[model samples]
Target: MNAVFPTLVPDHRCGFWTDGADELETALRRRADVLREAAGEGTRLLDLAALPDGDGAFDAVIGDQCLEHAVTPEQRLRGQHLGVLSRIFARAHALTVPGTRMALTTLTAGRLPRSAATNRALVDVVREIPLWRRCLRPEDVAKACGRWWEVREVDTHQHDYARTALAWLGRLRDREAPLRAEFGDQCYAACLRAVQTFAGAIEDNQLSLVRLTLWRTDQ
Candidate 1:
């Protein structure tokens, strides 16, 4: 389907792409035909809770880093999880010619640390509200997705994340000047430190990236 921030790294595989940063008119000018527009954040656009009409109603959907930020992490394991996810899946299923597939990739915290400080740090970043995150386990994610769709594959990449973070840190440092020029020192510096922290955490394996795939099954 469409990606919220698809233009981040261009690839020919996507059907529709949009970036939030671009002006609406400018985005439209780039591609005159923007079949459906859903405002608001993330994949949970209540407007399209039901399937759309006509040919472009996509059967196959793909998302990345979208669901983890759900208002409540534990909600996935709760009963509402099925209803919420099912509505989206059913709509996507309707668009496909009976056998279209949907794939979603996301990151989940690998394991919860026993330390209260670490838990609070996670919660703080997750809610972005400077509060401690309620800890979640990997099983929580798997169980949530399992109820509604068949999980075709699951994988995790753990080791090189630290190295990756180091690279990111260096890049942010190098680009700080240009970033500050475009977005001011305050904004640039804030972002630089944030990225640096993320990279540092990943490098230490204190954070992890998890990938999961779900396929809609015909009833």
Candidate 2:
């Protein structure tokens, strides 16, 4: 797991952890993360379709860099995510109320068609991110959630994402020796390459780090 952005807030019980791996529960707990996983449990989002809508259980669900990796590295897994976006949105709708919303941040495609360089960058990213992803445009996501929510705002942080990627790449490279020792050479290389790919994608306008805020509508 890329501990780079683990969504933990110090001196506040504002954030909670929800991951599929039971092994991470202990680690998250140690970091003062309100662990949502028990000793034996599955991911809440995976089987979210089965559970009845909470109808206001959560204040909001933040899909931070989560949607892009919703599809696994294998194409067969894409069906479970891209094709079933409604299920995911349904779960989100069920979790919040009329006024609450889902705030999502992920990689989204721009209006421009992808160039060859951009396509190549994507290949490197897929290899490093280990996900067979479908780039969902911001509008596409809004349409997918149309039944349950409204797109209140869609902000593109293109340059910022590019800069952040470069910064992360630098920080990661600074610790390359230890990272290589811990994660093996291939994994370390992949992580480094992924950051480079993202920087390229953001620079070329092939991708943007988007903050899409969806407001709940009475459905």
Candidate 3:
């Protein structure tokens, strides 16, 4: 199954996946190869949103912790640049020859209704008072994806993800010397701090995963 990666970034290496691997071991091997190629610089990852005639022809798509930053939130819920999102979804739909699936991992704030209401309140208050903008909530993501795709699953990566992020932050801190040498001190420090913030937020249940899948029906 071919997949499209919209708004893909160059410097932040995301990782890799393989298609049609029912066996775990086989998929692991294929994933290892993809990782090796990603690390070895054999494949040229291009920006999908920028590709000309970049529609249709894939069976599935996988995105992790992306799309939120792809377009500004103002552009999403406020009915701005929705055409772009629809176009991407159309291509993804065409890729699946009907009854196929698209699995995506996106950043969301979970499905608790009260939490959503509170977050909205926070956003409204911030909008009026002018403080830091809160991150996107799962409801926002659901509304966005529901525009073009039928969602099948929504999972909250609450506490475990926080632990994972903390672990990653710790590892990055440990590799400070090498990271500083490669990326310079300022960038490395900023990234390290960002990692900690993300972990803290996730563990605190302020950030979550809005797991989703979409299947195209013959129309």
**How many steric clashes between backbone atoms does each model show?**
3, 0, 1
What lDDT tens digits, residue by residue, belong to model 1 across residues 34-106? 2221111123322232346654434445544345444254554464544455555555555554344444434
Model 2 agreement with the true structure over 1-219: per-residue lDDT tens digits? 244222111111111223433223343243222112210122233222233533545554456556665544353234444455666776777776556555665667665534777677677566544532555667657767857877777767676556555656676788889877877787677667766776776688877767666766775
Query: Would you estimate the TM-scores of all the predictions?
Result: 0.54, 0.62, 0.56
Best by lDDT: 2
User: What overall lDDT goes with each candidate model?
Assistant: 0.44, 0.55, 0.47
Clashing pairs in 2: none
Off by over 4 Å in 2: 1-56, 72-83, 111-118, 180-187
- Candidate 1, position 212, lDDT: 52
The full ranking of all candidates by lDDT, starting with the best, is 2, 3, 1
By TM-score, the better pick of 1 and 2 is 2
Tell me which residue pairs clash in candidate 3. 58-95
RMSD, every candidate, angstroms: 10.2, 9.7, 10.0
Query: Which wins on TM-score, candidate 2 or candidate 3?
Result: 2
> Residue 116 CA error for candidate 2 (Å)?
4.6
lDDT, candidate 3, 1-219, per-residue tens: 001011111122222223332333343344334323322232232222333354444444555445555556566557553454556665555444445455555555443335665556445433432212324555555555544567666655454345455545666777779768877776665556555555555556666645555444455
Q: How many times do residue backbones clash in model 2?
A: 0
Error of 2 at 197 (Å): 2.2
